[model samples]
Target: MNTHPAPATRETGGAIAPHLRRLLEFVEPDRDDVCLDVARGRGPMPAALGPQVRHLTAVDAMPAHAPGGHGASGTNGRMSTVEFGTGPVRIADGDTPPAAATREERRPHPLGPDRTLVKADASALPYRDNAFSLVTARFSLYNLGDPEHVLRELLRVCRPGGRVVIADLVRGNLTGPDRDRIERLRDPDHPGTPSIARLTEMITSAGGSIRRLDVFTVERPVEPWLAGSCDDATADRVRRALIDEVDGGPRTGAKPRIIGGELWFTQSWAHVAAEPIP
Candidate 1:
């Protein structure tokens, strides 16, 4: 078991392959097994992880997580929309995925019948115990109110000897008050990023044995990141803070820098896989 955390690193182009590959490497899904992706929310997971498994269950807290669904969240200047339906599934942001969805819609869907969308609480999964072989969640911890509880639930639904993986932005060692304030301003639902050490503990406490832990960074232009995510006032505050950090006022460990005349910042993330005690 690897207990020591990896150092922060950086990547560009917003490509999804590297991260998705790392998760697959750790989980190593099989075609005959069922996998659950919690808090999927129209993320890159469905397209990337779906093809490799026998069945993929994608769940989100709200209908808005799907394309054309009710409610919307800012993403690359577009919103996720999904047509919803009535079912036993009920989800809430910070809790989990959706319950009902249209299967035959010709609209640009990344998943097929092999995939299912459910609205349910992450902390209170509606599935039977040991129902899945692999379970995962991506980029959702910062918004979760009780990540530990959710992890335990994920483990609970995972079959014995199965694995659970979580990937999210890790608070840099240099992260401090200024950076936290900016993050909250940009996304009010942001509870705050967690350190790699803290995350390891969360999984282990959930009865998972650590198998792998990898760290890397993703770089993005600052302006676009804050564009639709925040109001003018809050965006201004974030910009000022970034400028100060670039000028050496204080480091947020976000690595704010000017590249090709555009302001950019890097966020570190940790990808972890842990197996349940069989």
Candidate 2:
């Protein structure tokens, strides 16, 4: 198994919120239902899904190191900023930082008295068979060395006729230049996201049926993508490559077309709902 930590995009919360909303729209958990958020980094979905479910479980592998230390601190990892919109604009400012921090602070048990956080692996969930009524994972599927094994485990723990929801970025979703930029920066252990067709097959083979699949488009301003991090070199490369893409279309091949707007990149997400066989 790959022990390396995966790189989480700065836009995780923002990019994932809409997809969570959509998943909630379809699953609509009852107050008595048991829900689990697999690979629950900083616990976003659990916060949203907790109120509606009888019990919420947030699980992930124990971090080997803390945000600023060498020892694993459970969920406290490095912070990355995500900016939205065009030139010289900050979607979230100083006040926003506190709010974001507050949100994360509440992450440990955002669902309150009824929720639990577990340090565990996705491929071999510690829960018993048919233990939960609903299971959800976001932007986390690609990190697994065996996504199929993990999906099967999720299905195993879910109750008969219960639901499993997965949200992830598609490999070809980004434009050429942006894709290249990501590929270069991406860690070797970072498994490029799987295609939609492959994901669908994995779910069905595990004795689950697909209910709904949707793609959400998110556009981030170039400046934020470049300047959000502390690393100057990465920021510079991103900035220069983006400029090159703007100047020369496919001719440059260094940048992909900015979809939605001139300075924005696209993230394609697939939300799949599967039901366990009764």
Winning candidate number (lDDT): 1
Per-model CA lDDT versus the true structure: 0.62, 0.57
Weakest ten-residue segment in model 1 by summed lDDT: 91-100
List TM-score per model, in order: 0.72, 0.68
lDDT of 1 by residue, 67-114 (tens): 333011243221222222222111111111111111112234466878
Provide backbone clash counts, one per model: 20, 2
Across 123-166, the per-residue lDDT of candidate 2 in tens digits comes to 77788999987888876665543778778888889887577878
Deviation (Å) of 274 in candidate 1 = 0.8
**Deviation from native of the Cα of residue 62 in model 2, angstroms:** 5.3
